[model samples]
Target: MRQLLQDLFDKRVNQFVSDKRSKKLFFPKAETKQACLANRSAEIVKVKAAGKIIEESVEDEFQTIKYQAHYQYLIKQNGILYMEEEMEDRLAKFYKNALVMDEEIRPILESENDPETELNHLDLEDHTERLSYAYDRLKAVQYAERWWNSYNPAYKKFQNDCTNFISQCLKAGGAPMRGYPKRDAGWWLQSNNWSYSWAVAHSLRLYLSNSKIGLRAKEVSSPDLLKLGDVICYDFEGDGRFNHNTLVTGKDANGMPLVNAHTYNSRMRYWAYEDSSAYTPNIKYKFYSIIDE
Candidate 1:
């Protein structure tokens, strides 16, 4: 098992260093990485992989192993070098000490749907009070850096945690939360209950677009318009239902955003997400600049 994993890790590093997309039947991630690198005028100058077997079981001469493969890519773009990292959960099966099956375990985002009835109940007059507050961008980015790969025990962790994680970052920045006790009305989380906008990507996208009071944002025309501590929402299928959200933590050499996210926990990653397994040719994005007043 050790030798098999070593060989596989070697191949993974070679694939990135050569800038050739993996031809392995189940390797869509490698293909996506190469495609994204090309789109960004980036190349992998070096690559490294570290693997750990997290679980192992055996039955009837067959051994099944669940492992994590963490990769670090030294990418060069516009004459600057940036290190991007990601981790993958993978499963492998071996029979009679020979490798048989190997595949990535992809995460499923929670279902995408809205409660229209709840939206209708929201008080439109709520916006008449434009409560002013200061946004602490530095603290927000600090929180993102501290918890990108881990869950905060103070909040309820969701199966699809991207939006919930982004909400935490916004709250850390002093974005006021209101319309609590109503799941669809505003952006808030309290006592085991959370507004849809606080935990759902699609709902948060709508709230940022339409809200005029607390925790409001302005939709930007492009990703480049986003600043540190801003938010980006993704509709990977481009079918109008958003499924993922990220918080900007840094900028690349070309001034494009580098973001941090949970669910598929990542940090300082290129914002485009062209390399995401969920990415599609029709992927749509909404860039939002958090309003601070």
Candidate 2:
């Protein structure tokens, strides 16, 4: 199934690149196009282009695919059923806590646009106080390994581990999960089981669409345009379906963007473009930033 998914993804990407509509409408800007052409020409001249090396370096930083196959196989064999269940349950708890955190930070988000009003409300030296509040709220919700161990062994293994962590981050940042069906425990709880990808994706969509959070989606070309709390969506293999999602943490020493993601193969890890090993061709990526200001 994994191989099939990869092949299908690759085929879709190849078709997309080969399509005339995509070539004309979706190509990078003149500057980026020129750079791509120049790099290709340089590769032809010396059979070794420095830019190609750099691209390879960027792709290599992500090592997700190496372990994805193993996990996929385990899932297929039902060997990790218990672990997956544990993860789902733990994720549910995490989501519950995230809901609470969002409530606690409501004042901060409400005052995000007005620095003077925010400063007046809190006794602080500068923006550091608010920033520290945000950071501490985020840190307090992060459950380490011990929290994971508290779950049943079976429920811990095969879940969408990265999305679970990211959900907490989103809540810390004041994005509450809304519009979910009511359950005995919470308002956002759903009776149906959702894929990890779906849970995170829908949660984000809900938050952005809600008037309270006020995150407006935007079109972005390069990772450089992304901010610390921005969201990146990937159409792995160039198909219309956006399958992967990540958060932009910051930039690396070489100025490449670093991402936090829980991918099928990579689990949870920091990734960058310089690592070619991480690049899966035919993926059309889109970015969106939360509108705090």
Candidate 3:
């Protein structure tokens, strides 16, 4: 009887676990679904005395306001700074009466009468390379498809795994790692340790834009213009502050790019993530092409 039960369990495991398993996830339990939709708030040291409203726009059913705060904030792990983003906040005021949606009351934030704080310049080196990107699109796409469900053992898993997974895909495409023992800059992965760009979506965006070599990008207008290995930055709240990233892995019969990302653990998913919990009526997106020469 024990042998019979063991045989049944082994058969189930074999049927469930595979390198080509479906990336389309479906969690029936409420608790299981909540785990995939959690968003990490900023780790700010000193919040702004008064946030300056930099930009504001109203979409079909929601209003988005981009505010820059005066503060010092950094995401540091083990006393080393990984990434320091601009202290900013985006407010998405939803008009509940506009559409038939769930009940959500996003509190509006108010700024004080103080002026915007000054920022100091840090002496950072700038490295420029005239070389072209040699990252193989086929390899990155393959790696993404293979490991989208089951993670590779070589990399470190984080609470937010989307950017980290993308970094692995980029490395599989022959993007060399840089920076060791320090987490302030460079997209490096050594001894299972990785830089901020390898894990943080916002930091990866900055690194790709500012990189001199290895990886670089140019912003495009829409996802339809993106190539096989391009990236799409998701501003689920329609704010300028992007919070999620996905890689283009496949295209459908209509030629729309199907993307893959982690955290929610999706593979070859739809590019327009209207199903995301953070998605708002005023959601915005930025498309970038990872330039290869």
Clashing pairs in 3: 133-293
Candidate 1 residues 103-146, lDDT tens each? Answer: 88877776443344434234323557786788889999999999
Which candidate model has the greater TM-score, 2 or 3?
Answer: 3
- Per-residue lDDT value at 260 in model 2: 52
Off by over 4 Å in 1: 19-28, 111-125
lDDT (C-alpha, whole model) for all candidates: 0.82, 0.33, 0.56
| lDDT string, candidate 2, 193-279, tens digits | 322222344233333333232223465667777667566665554645444456655443333344555423222123332222224
Q: Per-candidate TM vs. native?
A: 0.89, 0.39, 0.57
- Candidate that beats the other on TM-score, 1 or 3, i.e. the better one: 1
Point to the candidate with the largest lDDT.
Answer: 1
RMSD of 1: 2.7
Candidate 3 lDDT by residue in tens digits, 1-293 = 22322332243233222222345422111122223212222122221123455556667766454443322222222333322112223332335323222122222211121113311211112465444458798899999888875678877766566787888888888777765555646777777566666676666776766676656778888778888878887767765545678889976444567787766556555577654555678878778888886
Candidate closer to the true structure by lDDT (higher is better), 2 or 3:
3
